[model samples]
Target: MKNIDVKSFGAVLLALTTSHCLAGEPADAGEGTVFRSLFGDTLERDYGITVSGLVDAGFSRNNNSSQRDRNSGQTNAPVAGLADENFELATMHLFIDKALKTNFVPRVTPLPGPAPSEASFGFTLEAAYGRNAQQARTYGWDMHLGINSPGDDNPDKARRDKQNFLAIPNFAGTAYLPYAGGFTVMAGVFGSGLGYEIPPNIRAARNPFASRSYAFMTESGAVSGVLLGKRLISNDSMLLGAELGVIQGQGNLRDNNDSKAVLGALRWRTPDMQTWIDYEFLVGDSQNDSTGDIQTPRGRLISRDGQFKQQHSLNGWHRFDQKWSIGGEMVYGHQEGDGKASTIDIVTGPGFDQAHWWGANMVLTYQQRKNLSLSVRAEHFDDPDGYVLFPSSTARGAFNAVTAGVRYDVNKYLTLRPELRYDWFDGQDSARPFGAGDARNQLTGTIEALVYF
Candidate 1:
């Protein structure tokens, strides 16, 4: 496994170097753009287009987990275990953007599949038009239109078997209007400006964290709404901001329902440092069907059916310097629903009325140099329901994990990252009847290479 990992990393490094060297020299380039003339007029202008992208690939191995079998597939310990080797081409993106003037510009980013297991490797364009007289005054509108085709060959099964092309057409916009009292009003659908780190979907794109473990409370699509208010105090030394929004419901596909979601957040930053604190709250009737099935964009499943869940989270991050940082987040969720017999009366459950889950994550990182760094993250989850239908044997459970990795910058355009992850699971004795006991542990190591353009 170690030999394979080294060979794979070396190959990716070679490819990235070759591509970077080629990119430095354009074919038959002799001040090409500046010399071009159109209709006796110089075509050269200060404005230009910029394009960039990245490709990441690597191999990983698992230790205590079940081996790869042709029938049961690969199992990587539900909570934490090692199983097999894997590789991925993380992201391949092309961005075309132009700055028309000091205040106006247009941009578009089209990306294809980043990994081989993806359904289809085709471009999905996200285009936008914007105007920004200054950072304090800016407005932008964007639209997305694409067709995603399924890669699976099965054509008969209805739920997870068939393969088809899905069309996506979504519109969203945003405006940041600043006022005299260090305040601003922001409004948009699917717009940016909700929090510090990017959401899970946008971060991973193709393979987002969708299982019950992450994102305790799930929403069907992007949050679409209007946010009001802004930073009460603003300066290089201190900052505070608050926002509220009324968004579309979680499972409403048509965007025509009267049900809605209300969200609020408060953020604070210390002066003269990269340290911040954020508190967020979400409440609403996020469920649609009364049946025990929850509808998601990918499909429908029965888990926390007909349950109303509320989530509260607090997060903090501190950057000691350019070379080191630490961050952590704590999240709590509570669900109210009809219990087994009670849900039977409402035709929704066989559920737990007062189900709840909570977890926390901590991360530490050190940048040894411009081209190398090391990071470690530890996380825990406590889910009373083992993602099963009501009255299952798995009553309550807890999972804990620690991941450590080192990243090396092969060059300006390429980077290699190797990581090791360990996980531990604790649950009822009857929860798992297989060879594994109530407590299980596993390990995984992955080496990834990224090439940026």
Candidate 2:
């Protein structure tokens, strides 16, 4: 709700840049020696330090695609051209960890090696620091800091600014859970647990079907207060878990209002099957409103009188065998706003809810080997408010798409993926396409690479 002066904001950006540069140096030094230590059995005695990263560079040709040129150019149908491209950066990450043995802490009495079992505190100070290249280009630095608690088992836990698709226990130190286990309390900024694609914050590319074309839910942001509980029904087959939280509503950053949200989920898993259903309810000032008043640089922005939004999702995954798997996700959400009648045709009618939308995705994958895999995915989206595209329209549009791709494990530390996609639009006559002119069909190709250590 408050805006920082340009100078103060610039100072914060500078500090972040310096921090990222410093973090990258140490990890880069540790990368070379990590492999030697692991293979020589020295890792057991020494801390573990590893480095990994990826670089993906490739050429793509689009058919029936349109392009806009900044320089002098001639208009053409499905214009096509070729040139060297560096669409995405391949990264190499370095990690360093020190493992303090289980008995390092002293027990109440005293036992062997380090301390007594009962009194001993089994813990490890796992600190992670890294810098990314994208940060260098955009923010002048990519600095990260992470610390994990002792005996923490969930590796997929959420992280600050990191987005995750499934709702699971939080292992990342950033999560604001009151307690770690059984009737836990958590609060902080965490990813939305709906949607099939990886949370958008950490995504390497855009999610084709997200409501906002360039906005990934992961990057949507969060500021939350939560309470969670989990009950294990069976050793491995059933589990019931629930989470309730009040989100800050002002996107992912700090703000002064109590825009609240509640979420709950139930999960079941076996060797061959897994399924989950989640519900989310959001009530508060519209994302466009904060502090009961909408303030903008130019003047006071009007707040919609009865604006509210809600979303729901269901997801499941099944492993048919060691080599094949199938999964699907469905999500729907609606936004309603009340305001004075508007003469503008694009605006929802008088006191009308402006946006109603729903969509879903399904994917099937096959692992040909340890180093290779293939996947096919389909997605559909409908936006009645025309929120996804500019020139918000009164006529709703629907979009459907299909994508196929292959992932190759270039090595233990690197992976490369190449994909091709096609998209189609329903009600072509009712809405304009993404590019200029009247086109309804589109195609795209991409190659991505990932590296981890």
Candidate 3:
């Protein structure tokens, strides 16, 4: 072994990694990947572009599958993710980033995150494909992409494929001005920056849970516009941050209404670095589009002219010990439009009165070992007026969920999350949205693998 060529072996490893990674997830993979190991020097050194990606897939089993058809697919109705039964061809993401000109790839990167005092300019372009892409699409902007169905012409109308979900979740440029602590301005298509969890779907999973909560599933998607953020106070111990933006409305890629939406956030990181709280909101007109393009078989399902929509949230977390931590989030959202019974998650047309919905969630996690951690979450969302959430025909009114999962780092480049989740509907007895649209409750067990390179 001492006589072997080290450099030649690395090249072989690069090629083998590329082929195996593309084909499927690796069981015990090496730290160095294809692009990062091969072009990590050239791309980052020459053009300042860092390329990274991850593939997250999972298999979920629903207890109610017996009451449903195998072809219909098992589902945890009302939850955006975890909707599929058996194997889920989850998010496959890629990122092309130029963040902080001076910082690029190296053999070993230390924990010193983005420096506060230094000014910088950068950009990010991310492409994602999977079930989550249906929620990540920039609304009107990417019509042909991220649709829920297969090709326009297919015998099985219920069939879906990765080809339908080629989505650009984020595309934006940024500039950091080194004045009064630091000011950052970002524009183009990016996130609303309002929620506790986001489907960044690049580099890695932004949230700990493999399956998202009802609050997160009902929250708005990416927006098109500009955002301005500043570090009001910054130090080694504490950091106070705030941001504001004008967008084309949450989920709406282009301007559907004559009016635009306003979104912002105020965050506080305590001196101990073990606790933080954030208050974020989005308020404005998101309706006014009558175009048939956005319609669904359920009916005109989203946005209405002159109806103003708003959502507000308060969330925080505190750590009592290195291994034990607790976090929670509260949300209140409503539209100044007539209430309506939704056949799907989004309802556009008018109904009885104004709509109102709210939700709360709590998460507790334990770091059992250096390479493994355990998490459990309890959440409830109320769509009393039959608005905000609608996963199945009978899945209306309110939603409740309990989830427990563990994350195991198999290696630097591989992660595995096996989760158990239970959900129930609190609506009409006559309508059942679970058990393949036949039962009132559902249990799903899932194992998700995240492979990064």
Best by lDDT: 3
* TM-scores, all models, native as reference: 0.64, 0.59, 0.82
Which regions in candidate 1 have their CA more than 4 angstroms from the true location? 1-17, 22-52, 64-67, 70-74, 77-85, 89-171, 180-221, 250-258, 290-294, 297-307, 340-352, 387-395, 432-439
lDDT-best of 1 and 2: 1
Top model by TM-score, which number?
3
Evaluated at residue 306, the lDDT of candidate 3 is 58
- Write candidate 2's Cα lDDT for 1-453 as tens digits: 011243653354344334425545342222233344346546534444322222222334344433432111111112111111222222223323332222111100001232212311111111112111211110001111112221012222321222111111111122112133323333443333544443221223222221122112211223334434333243344444454555545232333223454554554444222443333334444433333432211111234343565665556667777898777777666555554452111333234435557777777888899778888877776765555332212235776777788877554334566777676677635564523345566566666544333
Give per-residue CA lDDT, model 3, range 321-400, as digits (tens): 97998888899987675455331234434353466789999999898987798999999988776666643332446778
Off by over 4 Å in 3: 1-32, 46-48, 101-118, 145-164, 201-206, 235-237, 291-305, 338-352, 391-394
Single out the weakest 10-residue window by summed lDDT for candidate 3.
Answer: 103-112
Give me the overall lDDT of model 3.
Answer: 0.65
Mark the regions of model 2 whose C-alpha exceeds 4 Å error after superposition: 1-61, 64-86, 90-181, 200-224, 227-229, 235-237, 256-258, 271-285, 290-306, 341-352, 388-395, 428-430
Ranking of predictions according to TM-score: 3, 1, 2
Count clashing residue pairs per candidate: 6, 18, 4
